[model samples]
Target chain A: MTDVEPLAVTPALEAHALSLVREGSRVLDDVSFTVAPGEIYALLGGNGAGKSTTLLTFLGFLSPSGGSVQVNGREVGADVAAARGAIAYLPEAATLYGHLDAYENLAYFLDLAGRRVDRAALEAALDQVALPPEARGRRMQTYSKGMRQKTAIALALLRDTPILLLDEPTSGLDPVAIDEFHAMVKALAAAGRTVLMVTHDVYGACQVADRVGLLRGGRLVGSFEAGPQGRIDTETVHAAFAARGAS
Target chain B: MSLVFRIAREEWRLWSRSRVVVIAALTIAVLVGVTSLLTARGVADQAANRTARQAEAEAAFFAQPDRHPHRMVHYGHYAFRTPPPLAVFDPGVDAVTGQSIFLEGHRQNTAMFADARSGADLGGFAALTPASLYQLLVPLLLIVLGHGIVLRERESGTLAVHLAQGQSGLTLMLGKALALAGVGGLLLLPVAALALAAIAGGEAPLAAVLLVGGYALYLAVWALFVLAVSLWLDRRSVALGMLVFAWLVTSLVVPRIAIDAASAAVEAPGKIESDLAMLSRQRAIGDGHNAADPAFEALRKQVLDQYGKQDVAQLPINWRGVVADYSEKKLTALMNEIAEDRMTREAAQSRVVTAFGIVSPALALGAASRALAGTDLATHHRFLRESEVLRYDFVQALNNLHARALTYADDAARSSDPEAEARTRVSAKAWSLLASFRFVPDPASARAARAVQPLGLLVFWLAVLCCAVVVGARRLRP
Candidate 1:
């Protein structure tokens, strides 16, 4: 049951009027979005802003009250296994199996996704993630935040899925690890993979994301598109974020 | 399948490092070895002692001086039933049932000197046999080892990673189940080795195989049950609580309730009532010793008419011997009817216990284990039945001796004349003609056949729990 092979030529991600209610409160209200191939879409929001809910709905972890979430162009929750197969997710905590070493955890998770890997492949993934060879055989309990994140991204690379979802991937990372993560994120986008990073780090989003959107009160209040622009207009970005709804 | 094994391999490595798991496996292994050795030795001692006692009783009976046939009938014989070679693994109902029985003419006796009559602690706290260890403690160990397979994953957030990687809930549950079953199999290796040794030493091979297979099936069931609860529950403590509760209800509470329910469902008449029924039937057949009684007087006239004799002196066969033979035949038939009725009621009671196997596989395992070991109630019933048949045969042989060896003129005057008394006494060789009571245990095929129903019930439980685990696993989310 764990082995879900992908359908060829599926889109990265798509959502249509996704409405969600939790505990009798409208969390995500008719929110619709898409992440194109080779694009990094940063979703920004305040607390109680339905940012996590939208991510969960997209992953098929939460059933939408009204509307649909699609990953790899397949309807979410309709065929959750297939949908999950088309995407790689890196949680905020990036908790790997504590009892298992990095290499064992990688092989197990990859095998679960129906991917066969040899020792060389496993070593390559760890090397790509910049995890020290010594750490590959050590228990994950001894790992730092940056190392786990690297391993997670390395797993996502092994997954080879076109879409990646990062839930505050840099939340607890140090400044140097954050820079390293941003570089990895930019590299993944450059390699033509769609990445949707759900975060509250406004400055980090402006720095790395091809486009940034402010989500508040169950809606995408504003969209700020940017290129390798001169400099981010912090005042203007803040003003747009401060606007509540229907602007 | 490969992915499931991969997951299992990882868990096994973890278990190896887990002090709690290693300690538990070692403890259960020790218990199994100790219990098997002690129980086997105890049962062997019991069989040897019973055989020796039976031999002595047979010698005493055959050594009796020449005596009148009727007097010899009252002396009776004792029959001792030996435990089957596989009794060490299960002991079954042997501890609670008496191994020796006293057989006599015109009367049937229940097997006495049962261990239960003395105390329940004969083998310590519920007769701690190998079967009990498999039924009670192994499941407890399984629960301790695996009740957190899924919950720990969910709590530590590995389940999210797995799910995000496209791993279905069913696959995860099955992998955990396989891992738990592997541990159980490892722990049970000693008992399996002992069973094979028993088979090599002349125990029924089929029965031993079934014993091993049945215990494996029983343990698999617990593994699936653990996975079912682990998937359904969110908290490790809660899952462990529910699994332990299930163990208690199925293994301990249900067996006792099954017995009480069976006794209530079937009304087996007590010994006193059955005795009264046999006595009434005896009275109806008339007294053989009283010639003045109307029933005997009518019989005497009929015999006289048949022989065309106006008196006892005219008949060629001794009329007293004829009366004894006639009374013995009628009384044996009446006693058989009572015995058959009692056996039927007991069968009905045991059936009730078997029917309860649907909700409780523990009871089913016990029943199958007993059946394979040849120590169940069915085996006990055979012992009693065979003893009665032998008793009737020997008694009838003696009655025939009385009719043929004694002349009517000499037999009737035996009490009045010393010469008649010496002539009426039969040769001592007549006692040797009777065979000793030999219990023929049913073949392994028959016992294994009887165990099929309970084994099927165990399979059904595993199948159902497996389904539950799959269903519960499918819904796993972060």
Candidate 2:
């Protein structure tokens, strides 16, 4: 008998014709996308473009009014705990417990996600996010925005979840920190993690994402992908984003 | 459950670092401790003072000189009401209801030495006992400290992260409530110690236990109420405003209005009114004091017939003493009927107040606390009734001596002639034959039984608030 090739692997995340209505207003309309294992997909748009709303839908925070969202080939609404268990979310301007130091915040959140990581693993994750070693033991209230973001990102990294959903992940980061974050995201993808990030920064999304979907007025208006150079064209996506703004 | 506990620990850690929370907790602990000590001292002092006065009155009664029995009837004894041991915690209604009543031959006297002269308006929380702090200020402290437990999470976006970490809404709600309840339990510690001390001091053990339990449940109810309000509201400021308004209405406004409404709804006749009614009834029975009244004339004829003598002088018993004894029995019977009617009206008024407890947990908790401590209106009425019974018994015994100890001729002439008056006097040792007045307090079991209805009302409040929490939990979201 001829050897049979393995069937195509199921996508780690899928949003098919996802439509959401919130407070009597349509926030998402007919959005469809797929994030395979080891892929980073970014939904790029301006404010009110439903980018964050899409990420929330996949995390089971918001139920779509029409169609559906799935995590690892299973409907999100069918098993919310399992859906959440598989994903680590970093929200826009992520704020951790101000009363707790960076290390404590990391441990607390990691414990909450049902992970029993040791201090060494936590430090390693913090080191990966390039958080200042001196600031790890001080209360986060005294921490700068970039420091807090780094702590939150380190927490997401320590969760070791198969899927990561991030919204405006680098909103307050310095340029160097933003570049480092991009490299970290790339490394996590190489380790076979599926990431679905939503942002308004076109150049940043192009720098890190394997595929970029441009959104406007709650709809996916255009799409782009990396060329043979192994990076998406920033200028082309920027032109599309600006054109949509003008229209 | 472990997850809930973990979340609770985190919440404790967060609040423990908050200076405002720590200060508020310390303030409540100090207040409870001080209030408990001072009130315990006050209750002990009052109880000792009443017991001493009662003994002094008894000694004076026994030290009387030989005299006519009727004169002894007018010189009545005083019965003092010693407060129950549990009153240290509650002292409820005691300041308003007075502690001593005078017992005499032909009248029912109201209790005396009340702090407030009139009306049943709860005395405006004038008594600052440990129970009052538990009922009033602790709940306010709880609201001040915990109204932001859930709303703060939402406002800071930590709620979204928590949910994303796979924490269920129910778990979060319950966990935060457990943390708040722990704070409430901390406030109750000093009060519990005092209650335990009362029990150890040979007080009503059941009542002391119930008092502690009632206050604990009350605090728990407040915790649930604070949590439900926090979960239902979307903003911290709004939750705080709503919760404070709720506390003011339930703890302060509603209870006072309920008491005033009860007093107004069921109007108990005043002492003057009851006394006048009794006087009119006495008149209908003919003046027992007037030996020649038609009512006693029949009694005189009956005595002659019983002795088979045409004249009272031939009878073995002194005729004038017979008249005094006969009239007194009739008067005592008439007074008792009138007194019973007045007591019934007062009891009805109390029932109205108890029914109003369903509307306010503060009223419910107060009723439970008072009933358990034996300082309620029911307990005071029991004291009055018992004293009246003793009054009737002792007065009748003196009248019996008047019939048997004196000669008819001497009793008749004693008022006009000095020699006959001297002869009519009985031995001073006769006073020793009479029993001393001792107020038998309601049994611990009975006092505990009276608290059941109010305790049930408190439970009902808890149940209703629990339902609200469940609904709020279901609707909780990031």
Candidate 3:
């Protein structure tokens, strides 16, 4: 009798043995990672450790030199539009058009992602992101960083893409805003969207991530699985960071 | 809502917020309005003056007293060029070129009385016509509206979010281009209204429609160029500076270079030199007024032989008048040769300038505008050629009267005998028989056909810029 391996389910996103080079400098060395659906994966790394490079590689801007990145079982480079349809991104400093109102910002971004939403839906998404009702029609220039981050999250909410790739999602937020962002991110993971966030703050990563990975020199050198409390132990993540720093 | 329209709306919102852009566009509109009004008034006044002078010339021609037909031939006629209807908007070449020409027997005259001689600040380039407004100011305003179109997103880090959200680089580029095109369309509306009003008011050619359309495409080309540079450049200030440099090169530097190239490629001699050459060539032929010039000896023999007479007195017709007619024919032919050569040289120069449209679309658009308005060098050449035709017909008709209406004895004896000179005078009714001058501009199809090349160049520029935008989009990176 022939033995065959049992197939479980395709990951929401999978980057297997990915390698990337920029301007003759190797930026990402053989990196393998996967984020299952409904899970929030946090990547902790220092500057120049290829944290953003991995995200960009998944975004199809930087082609992987060694392996592949797949979202919803479709390869990143094979059909970028198809793979892109399933992901929403919020950068470190999430930027909304300063000249556009929050409503317009949401509408424009949602439309770009092929999700047509009316004003009511847009306002609903803003509310979902805990944005104030009064800020919906005012230009984004008047909004604070937290409000801008809310607007960006609201775009992700409006786009309804299944995969969310966020870079420094909770950076530059006040303590209260940081707690609120953590709660909102937890709520997003509970609602069945896969979240992959890259950040320097280990506590923020431990607070919301179902699983955590430490990226150093573009490789996933260490990982921590979430406890029943839905948090990776900060002490273990810190030890990993310290060990990598010492070496 | 269509995606492109939404993009355009976003652009409009952004522009509305930019106080500088709003003020600049409004100022351009107001200036265009003022320029249109001034151009209309100026065109009307010039047209009226030309009409009046033409009437005076015609009245003076027929008011001649009884005189020898040959004497009336030397009286000559004057032709005045009429401004076309579209000239009220474009006023192309009218201020610099002469508007009146003199046509006399034996010698062709240069057009004289240009408006520049009055020195009313033509050199300032503040004439404020619709043509100058589009050619000079509208593109600047477009740059103000569009230079930050893409760079702003890049600088603010929104472009990465956009690209990561499945918005292809091509889509953003297209959206920004649509936005800039919308602004350009908005700016073009007022000038288009002015042109449309002129066309509807009567006496305007269908070619004026081409003028309006040409300006639209011209502005679109500007939009495309602005968007392409914005896509490629990394900073707003750098994009703006580069776009302004491009505008200066296309609108000012390239045109000047094209003019220099044209001047070098073709020799349009100075007025004095041209006149001297014509005089020299005319002298090489016999003087038309000298009845006994050796050049007319063969003509005299032909006339005498045709009449079957051995002596001048035995001929039925006047030998002196016949020699005068023969000399006029020889001189007219020589004048035609000289005039054709000058026009050919001038046309070659214009062609050289027009060919430079490959480098700068402003040259193409300016040439198209002037051609559509009937105020180009070609139009002026046509006027001259037609006026010369009229001159030849009238002069030859009077010369025919000289050969037919009087006797040879009377014509020759009139120089020595007073009664014979009195008898040699033909009736004034003969002067009335001379035809009036009329300038016929080329047909619409003909002029529009010639305009096809420049128009194609504009399209070519647009296509190339579009391709550049696409190429820029493919490698769109912050």
Best by TM-score: 2
User: Evaluated with lDDT, which candidate comes out highest?
Assistant: 2
List TM-scores for all candidates, in order. 0.88, 0.95, 0.93
Q: Return the lDDT, model 2, position A156.
A: 90
Candidate 2 backbone collisions, by pair: none
Best-to-worst lDDT order: 2, 3, 1
What TM-score does each model's chain B reach against the true chain B? 0.92, 0.94, 0.93
TM-score of candidate 1's A chain against the true A chain? 0.87
Model 1 residue B95 lDDT score: 82
lDDT of 2: 0.83
Per-residue lDDT of B227-303 in model 2, one digit per residue for the tens? 98888888999999999999898878886677667667766666777778878878766654566677677778888
Count of steric clashes across candidates, in order: 1, 0, 0
List candidate 3 stretches off by more than 4 Å. A1-7, A118-120, A227-230, B112-127, B201-206, B412-418
Could you tell me which 10 consecutive residues in candidate 2 chain A have the lowest summed lDDT? A238-247
Q: Model 3 over residues B1-478: C-alpha lDDT tens digits?
A: 3766676777788788889978998899899888888888888888888899889988998899999988888788788887777778777666766677777788788652212311111211346677888888899998888888888888999888778767678877888888887787887787678677767855355686787888988998999998998888888999999999999998888877877777777766766677788788777677666677887778778877888878878877776777777777877887788778877877787788888889888888888877887777788788878888888888888888887888878887889999999998998888876677667556667778878998999999999999999999998864
How should the candidates be ordered by DockQ, best one leading?
2, 3, 1
lDDT of 1 by residue, B20-41 (tens): 9889988988998899889888
